[model samples]
Target: MFQKIQRFFDQMIVMRDARGGTEISLELATAALLCEVVRADHSIAESEIVAMEAMLKRRFSLDEQALDELMELAREESEAAVDHYQFVRLINEHCSFEQKFELVRAMWTLAYADGEIDPLEEARIRTLSTLLFLSHSDFIRAKFAAKPE
Candidate 1:
């Protein structure tokens, strides 16, 4: 467990050396936000997990191994975080409006993955959208775009 934790934190170095610094950190930040959405409902559904994994994979172009590590690191980061500002700051600094919108959409998808939207989940996404400097229109648009058919 200790070694795992050490390796998890070491991901920054490994990923930075392997890829580049900003990309991996951005991925971590994005994943942490997704983790927040996953936990917003206070229930971790399997569908939510699957949705998160798929979104992360698609967004980051991560293979299974990297995806798994990112998911684990993000979960730990989210749990340890005192607030969302750190993650949001990193994302806002690095991501464009389109990228932020995509992230909000993914959050909505995760919120709806359990077959329903929880109030807490909605609130979480709303707050995140605002923090990401997105307008109400953007929020609503993403919500609808991610709404299940």
Candidate 2:
């Protein structure tokens, strides 16, 4: 537990690259956001986890071992997070607009994975989309794109 906390906090490390700029783990940031949405619904749906695993693999090319590790780390990170700002900030710093749109789409897919959308889950995605600076049109587009048929 304590070790997990350590690893989670390590994702916040501020490091200078060769050009003296801050760099953070975009993977950790992304997974942490997924963890946030999973918990927001206040129910542990296996379907959400499954959807998230597929989305992460599709987006980042993660294998099973890597996915497991990331899920564990993200679980801890999201539990420790005071707000979504930490994860959103990382994404905004490292991700392009299209990347952020894909994340929003992925989140919508998770929200719909259990054959329904929880109010809290919807709110979480909206907040994340806003923080990502995604336009209302794009957010709506992604929601429609990911909504369960």
Candidate 3:
């Protein structure tokens, strides 16, 4: 019995290591990208955070705590990132064009959360949208689609 328990624990450890330190999901990575865009303007308001959390929860079907964990991990990764290319590549490899557009839409929602658009935020969003292969028109449509009615 003791040997069996030890083997089980050993297997668990191996599985954990194989999965890496943290299995940052594609959705979490996408959320991190959106967080980077919202924070680019250097005015991360509480409203924006709240709105982001809500959107992440709804979009990913995550519970509040899970969403919070995802957001926290995303923020840390965003801060550590040296450039946007890594994120763009990850998104491109993992997401479809429509999903990328939805990401841009989420960024737009966060940008407009405080009822005013910051110029820096807009610029970052534009750059990110372009990197994601979304045209100006598609980005605009995404923004409109995510707008609060």
Candidate 4:
């Protein structure tokens, strides 16, 4: 009986650690924020989704299956989240200034994917860019850098 109890305790410890494990990387968190930006306008257009998938694949060097899996996981988490704090906290903890700037660019890229950036999308990007500690200059730079040619 004591051995069974000990085994149960050990299992509990393992489960606790596993539950606390980091499921999303900084890049994935950034991608999730961009996903939120794209969805902010109440329209997830095919162009936006395609641009997001392409960006994720190129930036992360992920194969199609891996990119799809990441997007699915990110979508689930982003949808389940109540606010942007979870993503902001992850970015704060794991990203550098340059990386954050790049994330903003990625968000801009996703926003422009539909050919016109909606007002809500712009607002969301501005709010999230500030939350990510990007300066206005950096934000503008990112926007230009991600602009479609």
Task: List TM-score per model, in order.
Answer: 0.84, 0.82, 0.79, 0.80
Off by over 4 Å in 1: 1-24
lDDT of 1 by residue, 1-149 (tens): 56864555565422332222323377788899999999987899999999999988987677787788889888987887778877887788878999999999999999999999999999999999999999999999999999989
TM-score top scorer: 1
Return the candidate ranking by lDDT, descending: 1, 2, 4, 3
Misplaced by over 4 Å in model 4 are 1-22
lDDT of 2 by residue, 83-113 (tens): 7776787688878899999999999988989
Top lDDT hit = 1
Model 4 CA lDDT for position 35: 82
Error of 2 at 96 (Å): 1.1
- Predicted structure 1: lDDT: 0.85
Worst 10 residues of 2 by lDDT: 15-24
Per-residue error (Å), model 4, residue 50: 0.9
- With candidate 2 superimposed using the best TM-score fit, by how many Å does residue 134's alpha carbon deviate from the native? 1.1
Which 10 consecutive positions of candidate 4 have the poorest summed lDDT? 9-18
lDDT, candidate 2, residue 30? 91
For model 3, state the Cα shift of residue 64 in Å.
2.4
**What's the ranking of the predictions by TM-score, best on top?**
1, 2, 4, 3
